[model samples]
Target: MKKNLKPTITASFLAIAISAIACQNNSGKTAQTDSLKQDTSKFLTQPLISNIYTADPSAHVFEGKIYIYPSHDIEAGTPENDNGDHFDMRDYRILSMDSVNGKVTDHGVALDIKDIPWAGRQLWAPDAAYKNGTYYLYFPVKDKNDVFRIGVATSKTPAGPFKAEPQPIKGSFSIDPAVFTDDDGTSYMYFGGIWGGQLQRWKDGKYDANGSKTDSQKEDEPALTAKIAKLSNDMLSFAEPVKDVIILDKEGKPLLTKDHDRRFFEGAWMHKYNGKYYFTYSTGDTHFLASAVSDNPYGPFTYQGTFMEPVQGWTTHHSIIEVKGKWYIFYHDTQLSGKTHLRNVKVTELTHNADGTIGLIKPLKK
Candidate 1:
């Protein structure tokens, strides 16, 4: 049931060009300046949908089609801050495509904040899974107490008019819930984010209203890691205690807090490739998409290097999925609006090297 949504390509193209200029001026880097001087058109990847702003795309293949569940970005007047008050998104619209670079369908508003009984506002990044004839939409949002908690919604179809549970998922906190189902039918959720994501606030297993935005003020101490837990058989809650997904350097030592280029900031996504598990996430303030590899689903992963360069936005969230025999990474940038809060989702092909390391991705073509 696709709706007749008109394309806003003309206006979006103009904005994209303007955003390239703005990024060059703001960055003042010689490489960026040189690239901008050559071909401004290469500065942006075409957005999947231009009619409405979207971000934090969690893409999946369901029933031989590509379905994307992303945060529905809006121009909420809340001021931008380190705490992320301006990303006041309230709902989600599911996007679908028949194949790569094919006609995309905006299935309209699949879920809204008002329908979720426990949610307060700011419906952020989400992920989806299909099992036992039901589709589960996993999302992170602020609760009545202003704490970010993860919740699940269910629907009969992949493109959902999902019905959320009356309460938040017990023992789930922080943001960005990425549910990865293993080959044995076991599903594990990898989640957590620092800064405005509130992962640092729960260091003592209790929420602290007063907590630092950064992780481990001491740089030598271990960086705060992402959390993982096995989902219950019904997929409503955690089956076991949440455990930290430890990331280590090649020397097998924990990454220090000051290692911004490698430390985990947020946006945890897991995918299995060639019998190895790949855990990837964004290095928030540093603006890089980095990865680590482990032999097990619950990992003490060793650090790999950056796979993606910065886009035109402050936040970088993504999902990697295999389509047919090819893999693609879905992400978002501010090209459509030239404002951080108003973003547009885009996708590009990804490659894994013969040595199992991921090839670096440049969101904007050089």
Candidate 2:
């Protein structure tokens, strides 16, 4: 939603980064039929191993380690004024790496902005869930814009000194926040990246947010739809109403019948298989990450496919990594003739169908 591109900042190296399920065979799957046949080409690779400070990364693995909660463009030279005007929200840091058991070599920065708390500037889009042993980050802030709120920090050490959950997380105006903990642990919180409505934060996990209870609507609820809310065991909020708690697009159609500005799902994430709920997002405009699905995570969703778009000059914000069972879709692009916006980072591989629905793979030449 903020435009002004021309990035190529040297290199700090390292990066990679969803889920949900619905019943969409919209033909984007291209139809193979053998139960939809999908090996996902072993979850391709290129999703930025640091094409530069990565951008909107948010992956998790807890003690298994793959934690990437991004939104620290550092402000670099400080001009370009894409509304973010060089993005100086104090760079809001929190980066780490372990890559399961084999390939991250081991990276650093477990929680930055000197550990956090009102941690000035702005530290957008973050999400992690560990429970009991403690980790829960969940971010988004102008530091103070009368409180553009979307915070909830704590840590028993997924990095260090997190602690900031004394407030923020009650049914209301949000940001690119995502937190999922399903498979039965039941926890959910998906926020609005806003262009106009995608809201939900009934925080059933307590922290109360002034006694949660929200249900929004203004007609245009489809910027491609993907907020994935469901939590209710006290992860802070939302135990219902993805429009009534996970079922897939619930009839909230319109991935863009006409560019009400590229119909983007902003940058939401979630992944749950065998039990269905793969609501991944990020649609072009300046974006590349794209996905849609819903079988319940707090949804009525449906529109499976397009995990990466723009072959060379339009890629977008994204995050998703699922090692061990395989499925990858981390994004960022533009670096050839150099300077369409200087963006970098790229990854691939994501396939499905057997009633699962998702099959993205395009962009490998430049």
Candidate 3:
């Protein structure tokens, strides 16, 4: 869902900087100070592209090249709120690289809100899939009714000027659509996000405009879970009813609503390693990237642990992929603009343990 309440740049700092600049006569000094403020030297992995703001990176390997599908961010001047009105993204731009730290190419605008007949605004996080010589782009955006729905766009080439369907996939709601194709050629879409993502609004399979801001308020009740569904062969529609993805504890009980640190929040991602299905997600407000494991695509997954600690921003979203036998994670933070809504994507090496557990990754280099 990609909403952050914290402001990376504090008000006091802004005030002090403005006062200092006003008292100075040299415009050159002011320009130099602004440049220094945008310094990204402390980041463990530098941003993939700096020409524009991007976030919620969905990385994949298509035809031996790394392709990224991310939300194109802009300063829309909308006020921030719990409903995520400030993340006023209107388009998507694809990125590609030959290697982990290689030069990244931004393939201009792949799709825009105006191109989709049903889309309203806020083109959030998106994922890409390939099948039968065609590429599919899955995304979440608000419709004219202001309800978020999942939409699909198609392209013949990996880097696309994609053509979107006239309407969103039927029965699709909420946000963060991630599609994973298994070795058997079956693809499952994992989605749903609490809070601003609007997953909690669909408790009874209907959109409730005045839904709970968080998950089930009861400490003993099962937490609101992420949603999953099998994608039809055509990849334009769901093959079955959307189901809840359950995360269990060591004793095999469902993760309770009170378990804020480990419960599913948003940014659902699945990857296969060592014949096991790894389900990873963001713990939105708590700001951790956690994982669970299951033998089947539809999971009663057991909680593993947090793989990534909090970054410099309020919202964290990511994707994991394997390239040439090496695994890497693509994620975003507020290092570039020092604002929650404007983020930059980055990539770093990911390690899987011998026992099938993921190693904890500290986003900060130090």
Candidate 4:
């Protein structure tokens, strides 16, 4: 019969037990690792410029600079210049700027899902991070059939209205969300391509049964050969029985014995240069982008190669920023000779070497 706790729920449980005893006695501030080195020789090329918004692009490399956010869908048959028709879009938001030494700036709508409730109103891919002081945006909606899911929002600055996260991340079926924070601090999100599996908020958000994965479920996990997931550390939970599995269709092997595309290895991105771990995915039936390597970072990877070619009308999902020294990939393109099929977002110039390999990018067309 102990039911008398009111006073704002006992002062919210004594301010969360005095902030969990002051974060176990002071240690609460450490999340900007991955300095990014190694790869002493890789130097790709191809994107000196391309459509800044043609649709759904994503890239990260904060603080020192290299942002290239996208997904600012707000179409109306689309048309501001040479081509029109952007398909369906009304207000999703995420358009930061900054490219590098050459200089660039757009900074419009850094983050806006319009207060995600079930995100039933659109709000496609966003992806961002900075932690601690704030600046987090993870998005993806359209729940029902195409069953897309994934929702999160927060903002301390990065030009945003961010601030969501009450639900929307349950068991995950598919979306386009992405977030990765490694180098020990741990924080992951990496979503799936179309309609598949991947869900983890771990650390406290919960769910890392090998860190979420499902392209049919194998026997209940660890079989991949592609489609992806690797979440954990409470960035909302993930990682447990989920193991290796990252082959590319025909050339790398395993289309899962038959019935492909829709799932081959959707988006799946993660970085860590020299020490190892370099995922990067997307393959066949369209959408190119490719790679493989794994000192660990939860992988059995090894594939490697193929940095672009989702064709001129559209390509694969990609993101990777660097700044301060140079490296950019942010992808998504629908050609625009008159607005072909609605996907915009492009950036270019991404390298890699020291012994990692990933060259030839160049894009840059806005």
Per-candidate local distance difference test: 0.85, 0.49, 0.83, 0.49
lDDT per residue as tens, model 3, 158-265: 888799999999999999999999999999999999888888888667898887876845888999999999999999999999999999997999998888899999
lDDT, residue 101, model 4: 29
**Most accurate candidate by lDDT:** 1
lDDT head-to-head 1 vs 2, winner = 1
Query: Cα lDDT for residue 6, model 4?
Result: 11
**Order by lDDT, highest first:** 1, 3, 4, 2
> Cα miss at 354, model 4 (Å)?
20
Which number leads on TM-score?
Answer: 1
Model 1 RMSD vs true structure: 6.1
lDDT of 4 by residue, 1-366 (tens): 011211111112223223322101011221111111322112222221222233556666566555555665333443442112233343444434444423334443444444565655445556777766777777766543334567666777665656778776555545566666777777766565522333321323343444433343444333344324455544553464333345533355443423333234556777777787777767534456777777876555666667664545544467775666666666764432223444545466677966677874534222
User: TM-scores, in order shown?
Assistant: 0.90, 0.29, 0.89, 0.29
**lDDT at position 354, candidate 4:** 60
Q: What lDDT does candidate 1 reach at residue 306?
A: 96
Q: Residue 49 lDDT in model 4?
A: 22
For model 1, what is the alpha-carbon lDDT of residue 101? 67
Stretch of 10 with least lDDT, candidate 1: 23-32
> In angstroms, how far off is 215's CA in candidate 1?
2.0
lDDT of 2 by residue, 288-344 (tens): 554556666666556565556554544356667786688765555443123333333
